[model samples]
Target chain A: MFSGSVWKNIAVLGIVALISGITVFTVHAITKGYIIKSESRYAKRFLFQVAPNANYTNDILTDTINIPKKYFSMLGIESGEIHLVKINGKLISIIVPSIAYDGYNGKIKILVGINLDGSIVSVRVVSHKETQELGDKMEVVKSDWILNFNKKSLNNLEPKSWKVKKYGGYFDQFTGATITPSAIIKQVHETLKYYEMDKSRIIKELDVFNEIKVSNNFEGGN
Target chain B: MYIRSYKSILNNGIWEENQGLILFLGLCPLIAVSNSVVKALGLSIATMFVLLFSNITISLIKKRVSGILKIPIFIIIIATFTTIIELFMKVFMYELYILLGIFIPLIIVNGLILNRAEIFACKNSVVKSAFDGLIFGMGFSAVLITLSAVREILSVGKIFINMDLLFGSAAVDWSITIFSEGYSFLLFMLPPGAFILLGFLIALKNLIDGKVNTLSGNERSSLKKETKRVRTTGPVA
Candidate 1:
């Protein structure tokens, strides 16, 4: 017990590190598949809520298009993924993950689903840090305020009508939390505008992507 | 190092040296996650898992490690168990994992786990250390669950409202609404409320301890002895 050599301490430390590292690695390897599956299942649950009407046979979790960094500011997100909903191999709708940087407490992440006609299928807040009793009404579990965005589109509402009623707009704002609703209204409007501007390019990219996937499967089958 | 009886060790963990109320260790996650019973329960189970395994592992290896190397070795073991629990939670309890967020990884830094490993587990047998871990974990969880229940009831006017987040769909209807909709006290949901409630809880515990002592007939002398014992920190006697 009196051996206090420096090398001994280092060797003991090394052995402990190696053993603990192996233990963690083994657990991670065992749970990796279930982790991935659970994550996808969670994502799919939200995706379906956003696009309930889409009769897509494809796996929408991986059917995603990455938004270019140039448009990040417009979408209020650092990075973005747009999930394409397909029915019988046809692009039916797209669920875009957007963020509202102007939320009362940091950002509010949402999934906005838009049909091919540019109308909103639905919108669901993925996560947010808004005030508990005030701004949190935006959550579907908390209130129906979020569902008010459904079936609305740019064609119907004037550009000025996008803001909350407090800002001289068509949408109603939470009495005690104007900023929360206004921020979401603005973000949803921007999401609609982004969908309109990128529709053609999005469809073209999907077509190219599907063709490559089909070709890859063809080669693998032979 | 000295050995303690199983009953004394259990009492030391759950009451005499209660990590939450007496030691005041790991208050960061306690305050952050105790707003909801489901969240508190999720973190409690995760922390208890890490603490139990880390204690057993450290006790098993204490003989080989000596001097300054012990702390780092203990940390590595604790972190390995924490990561394993985090991975399992992400796989099996996905919703709770998301709700708990960064706090799960932050379990590695929880002072309670490190304190147990250093002050008790390193000097004890594997079974004793495991018992210590389990009891201390229960002590901490008791505080968290109680705080969360009070907060949930006061702030949201409901108990177990989001039980499904932890127990799956079967618990969806387990919640009990004490007050009608829109009847909430927002203060209890905030951080300051946690501090206020925790203070009252400590006061109540002290009051109870005083009452028990007097009822046992030892009175003031035993109370003084108890405080003196708590004051003498470090490894158990």
Candidate 2:
């Protein structure tokens, strides 16, 4: 029986805490695998949105190239991944995940899929903390503003034309929300420039890695 | 202390002592997540699950716990259940898990859950406490869903939009557009709108209660008998 003594009360509290800790630990253990899978599935869903399923024959989710920390400044993200789109062993495009930290509210995460020819295949806002109704117009579900990025590249537009229309540029900004669109456009432009500069190096690295992987598979079979 | 009847407990939770409407507990999440129905529904279900389990656990251990240590123990139990629900949602309902975000973890601090554990669960039978938690949670959900429905419709001119976030892909078409494109009223999507709409809802509830009371008053007079009033304060009679 639990007594009115101080020690007994402490003991009861300790036991309750222990039981709760165990319960939570058990639940976490059971759900950990599924949680990771679901998270990756969510990330993959956005990747496919930027790089449509019809364009790529490879498993783009697994075919990601982790961007080195040194290139974080160029991508405007702390860390990033670029999913490769390949067909019959030939790399044709890549989806670059970029973040714009100057969103009206906070950072806006976007995925830009670009062809090897440097034109954009498509662009999708993966996540954002921008104001609702005004800044959220960038979403494909809400408006076609994001779709305007399709087929656009640095070559088609002069450096000045890349800014939102409010700032004498090609893209239209929401009536009350220039900051969010401007941030996204700047980040997308920067990501393209990063790709342009590093394209050859990334391809050479991928080719070498692929050759090693193929050789390892051959040896494993033998 | 006297034991409350099952019916009275249910009535107390659902209407007479509704947490959101009357008690006005847990208003933080009530205002924040109620901008959309799916988000409101997600938080409601998560809160209800925690409430039910925590109530049951508290009632079961009430006799063993001393007075001073009761609050901490109840909190630990509630937090444990909240974390468990968060993990479960992450695994199964990943989209909703992402949508609900911080509000799911914030369930531990919801005054409604802790209040029930302290006042009702600690003094009642486990079954009665569990039933109380269920009805109380339903009462809270009723207010949240209503508030969110009004907010969603007024702001976006749509109902059930993005139901798939909570109900999965099969519910993708469940949304119904009430107004044509570009007919949205932005005020209703903001937090200030929630406060104003919630005020109107409370007024409507009071009006309904007044009407019901008058109708019951006539019946009582005809019988010339004193009916037992639903106790809103003090020990159950």
Model 1 is docked with a DockQ of 0.77
What ranges in model 1 sit over 4 Å off?
A1-4, A52-54, A206-222, B218-237
The C-alpha interface RMSD of every prediction is 0.9, 0.9
Candidate 1 has a TM-score of 0.91
Residue B65, candidate 2: C-alpha displacement in angstroms: 1.1
**What TM-score would chain B receive for each of the candidates shown?**
0.91, 0.90
Candidate with top lDDT is 1
Question: What is the lDDT of every predicted structure here?
Answer: 0.90, 0.89
Per model, the share of native interface contacts recovered reads 0.92, 0.89
Go through the candidates in order and give the clash count of each.
0, 0
lDDT of 2 by residue, B1-237 (tens): 636898988888889999999999999999999999999999999999999999999999888886789889989999999999999889888988888789999999999999999888999999999998999999999999999999999998888989988888899999888989776787899999999999999999899999998887887765554332333332564
